[model samples]
Target: MERLLVVLCPELLEEQEDGRAARTFAGVVEVVESFSPAAGAVRPGVCAVPTRGPSRYFGGDVRLAGLVRTALSRTDTALGRVEGHIGVADGLFVAVLAARAAGDEPVVVPAGASARFLAPWPVEALERPELADLLRRLGIRTLGAFAALPTRHVLGRLGTQGSVCHELARGMRSELPGYRLVPRPHPATAATGDGSAGAQVRQAGFWGEAAEAEARAERALGHLEQLLPPDGVAVGRLQGGRGPAERARLVPWGGRRLDPAGPGPEPWPGQLPAPAPASVLARVPASVVDGRGAELEVGPSGLPSAPPEQLSVRGGPWQPVTAWAGPWPVDERWWSRRKRRRRARMQLVTSCGMAYLVVREDAGWWVEGAYD
Candidate 1:
């Protein structure tokens, strides 16, 4: 219905700091209809914004996209350097692919031709494994190949999803968009993203300084611990913009010491390593995504039962179910010997709804799908 843009830009700072060969390219997309990360930028670095409303107000999709580009350019100079590559297709997914296929100029996928454009791409591009595997087994490789097959057979083979893909071959990308749940990044002594806090980094160097790291770590823990209730749950999911491996470093204390003098984490040896920037931790709070229509209900059986109205989770009266749904009984994957479970069903929900699952499991209830 509209032109979705995937703007590719080169960072001058990275080049100036390093070399021309070390150019860092950024893709800032203007997503008119979805909340996808690739569709929009939603972080400290860059983001994507939807254009549906803009299109309605500005008379057309092209004008909406143009307005977005202008807004992006004006908001922040660094954010402004975006290079426009437009993809006009029936849906976001197809538009993005069309844009990807475009070279330097803005690529546009004309409406009504999305399904045809997508036919040549690999089956893997669809991002749905269940559908991809079934198609691959039937000797279908490209979207076109699958499209050429009997629609009824494809649907029967892959279930209801195959019909969507069949239509996609004709250039109708109908899959939902993807949005990145930006995890909260833990604050580091070296990290200056947040200001106005006590024990500033340079004021207290993390490693080289005499006890600053310990102090700062204490302050952070105190901040976190304060968030916990006194009598109930002790260890709850910690949510931040960062992941587990990306979790912030805390100056370790001796069991229950409130204020610690850093001799360098006692339990943590001097040579201990830090986690990767992208590492997501089990302790870290996972993101709960929005699912339209269906509602999640935690059955009264103390465990998840057949389709319920909504699901409920209480992490020991502390963390509660933020959202949930779906015991959407998946009877497939049974053919695979590895998947030969007495019973296997996936509860499609996020950490919020899962907290209750964990508590119930800890209380001797049958555990179900995790936030993972």
Candidate 2:
């Protein structure tokens, strides 16, 4: 589960008739956004930000929480003074509880301690009133007691909803039902022209349609970054190679900047034709045989001893080959003795209408890729 930092305002949880709570919370979100662009409003008076990157940048989780608390202190809101409670923990459910528990100092739950920290909490913390009542009647009044029930028995006796709660009790899932909300745009800041209290004036041309599109893209990316592990997101760059897997490589998406488009695919000698395979697979042992049920071989001259008539993958039943393409021989790094590779590749369509890219090295055959 991803570690999260939550900011909760008890006073602003419920909106007022004048909409002061929502506008105040939006200001709180803006303050949190200064620390991490991935910060998002979970509700009117609640917000969360993934702490992985920011914690490292600010030295540690304790320091990061302190900085966030200090920054939120200076934010002016319609409610006169903003009171933000900060907490850090793994997953959203426990993190929100941690925020509520915080007072003058931010609460930081140590890593890998979510289950232990949640064990003492009441079953009501799960927020399912029916489940909590049933568990209490069964003598399971605490999270630890509820989690101790056998998972299979829980599923069989209580059905899917109970199974979901079981996972939450065991600290397996990150969020509770309805914990995350799609953030709505702030009505005050989105207003323009009249120069109202929080109105943001917009200019034309470069800051018009293109700028709005870019801002939307950035927000989408920020939300994506929050869900993924630190540095987990990447973009693929195509390069010259013989096989589909080698023709492209994944590079980390750094600094939240998109690279300019590159030139399209270029012709390379011995490379496969256009319309590459849809999926690249690990080296799966396969069998390629002739009509006589004899294993086919690719001789030293890079020519097959006999035409392939059947193919079997991972010891599965053999499927008849309906159509086939050339044995494109690749002899790379020939100058280096240990680094050299000599292999033959062929594209074949099976009787089941599945297409595969199979390779032969020495006397062994393997399925390297598949076509949609």
Candidate 3:
């Protein structure tokens, strides 16, 4: 693979938005023979350019990086001091991380040493929060340990995502999975007379599991309601399931039918923005039934408070459940000596037919949320 140089603007967002980043990036592009934005933006905070042409024009990778930095320094002083870190490595993933670690100086990972270069970093550096959490629970603390895992086993548990992380740990070519919001094209490049040029679309996925993929799709759709213009609507099919064949039409979410009487807890006045509608509680107290079917009440301190009969929400009135599901167990972050969570969740319907997600963690059982 050709050595790729990654240029990262450490504080692009803090810089003036009136073309400062673009002008600086355009300067680098003028100097570098060939380059591409890693993502869709003209001046993405991070970009990769092949090092061959620039290295040959200058003395070497180090000299090429210095030249690019000098170009940026001269490009725009209106934005005040703008500095970038450059990393030269074999692949985009390592190159990006290397640039981040480079901090004002250019760092070059020797060709064929990308894997070794990445091995010492913590697995958390992978940046896929979910996959990192799973790895932590499995006792994989560092990239080297994760790289040592059998590929087949990682695939079986994490699916395509696991495979991607594994490849990164080994410093191989791999596509990062998950949703990415694409920015609109720069006005100078946008063509006239076509509404299509401004039409926006949000893309997400390539998830390994059907359920998780569907959940993410639903969350994405819910968010659109807030993102769209007042009179605008998004029209497209959510495509997933086994292959390209299975797809579902997008529709307004008519939330769960279970409407509880009166209102639940109102937001106690606060400056914090309301939590995202789909966020799950980090900790919740609940009435749990173990694998042996023994019922127990978990309290505010996350300790068993009483037998099943006395179980109730931490501070709410005792409401009887009409039906209940299993005590499905979940254990996460077990590798972290202090952050492990061993818990189980249950689906329950109250006497009024309202459903709730309740969880029992080491901290104790609590209600996660209402079904609706």
Candidate 4:
């Protein structure tokens, strides 16, 4: 069975100016990921998190919901304490509706009760104006009324989109015929990291002034320069840099950075291998780690064994470190609705003095990469 959590933040950007709203939402998504990786933005003020996996670790659904609420409450988005609703259910439609139905607390629908919980809600909750109009005309105002109609008849008249609506009304999976449904930012107007079309504050001309738009765009390039790692150099700089007008055309606010030499993201410094995704460990060890990555002790099973003794090494059959560097942290995917990642990377030199990249994530520690 699928499980979903809907976080409704009506005031997420109510206080911000044009550009700041998108940035604020990005920051908010980051906070959600600190609680679970299965979360993503549904819209500007709404986010959906799949909690089935993470909830088990935090006890049960109710307790996990409480923890999520606490996290959102403690999150200082600098936009103030915007309230959030946490709804856990079998489907996104009922889960979101349940969130809106809640007060200052969370709502958790039992495994198979989403359809029943959704039944009494009015057709308006579907948020489809045209379909609601049709349903009203037919005297089918509540979701239960709409769900009672034969699926074949609905499909014959309203087509695939109607099929989706019917499924939603019945609290079933919303997918079109012969197609796998892909998740989208709920309420389509929600801006992705790069901003939306016709609402391009950061991607296009700032504040929509055609005059000096090029100049503003040129200045954005300057901002991009500062964001890159010290070792990160534009490819254009290597092959005779292109003019500002050419660079200005690239979208700046998108999560993917632009390369002056080409259109794609600027290559990672020295083309370092990106972090490899791995299985979450069933058990995490307790260990003390600080910047410069020294005196780490781990058990044979690759778990942090214990706190390090000052100036003394705690040796085990596992990889013993001779030297180390970095607690270099990564906070990736903050710009999109699907926020992910909270981990620190450390380079360790084993007894053989061979270096390995290790990561510490919420799920536990794992060796990320190896130096050749």
TM-score of every model? 0.35, 0.54, 0.44, 0.46
Residue 206, model 1: Cα distance from true site in angstroms: 41
Q: RMSD in angstroms, all models?
A: 23.2, 13.1, 20.8, 22.9
Cα lDDT of model 3 by residue, 90-109, tens digit: 75567767887896778888
RMSD of 1: 23.2
lDDT of 4 by residue, 131-166 (tens): 889889999989888889986587557643565667
Winner by lDDT between candidate 3 and candidate 1? 3
Instruction: Evaluate model 2: give its TM-score.
Output: 0.54
Candidate 2's displacement at residue 304, Å, is 13
- Sort every candidate by lDDT, greatest first: 2, 4, 3, 1
Stretches of candidate 2 off by over 4 Å are 180-372
* Model 4, runs deviating above 4 Å: 13-15, 174-372
Residue 315, model 1, lDDT: 28
lDDT of 2 by residue, 1-372 (tens): 688899998877655658778798889989999989888766667788889999999999899999999988877778877989998998777898889889978999887777777888999888778989999999999999888898758755664456567777777665554433223344543343323321211222221335346546545655665677635666778877888888987754431122323686676789988778898887889999999999888888878889999999999999999999978889998999999999999998999899999999857998889997
lDDT of 1 at 61: 57
Clash pairs, model 2 backbone: none
Top model number, lDDT:
2
* Model 3 / residue 52 / CA error / Å: 2.6
lDDT of 4 at 15: 27
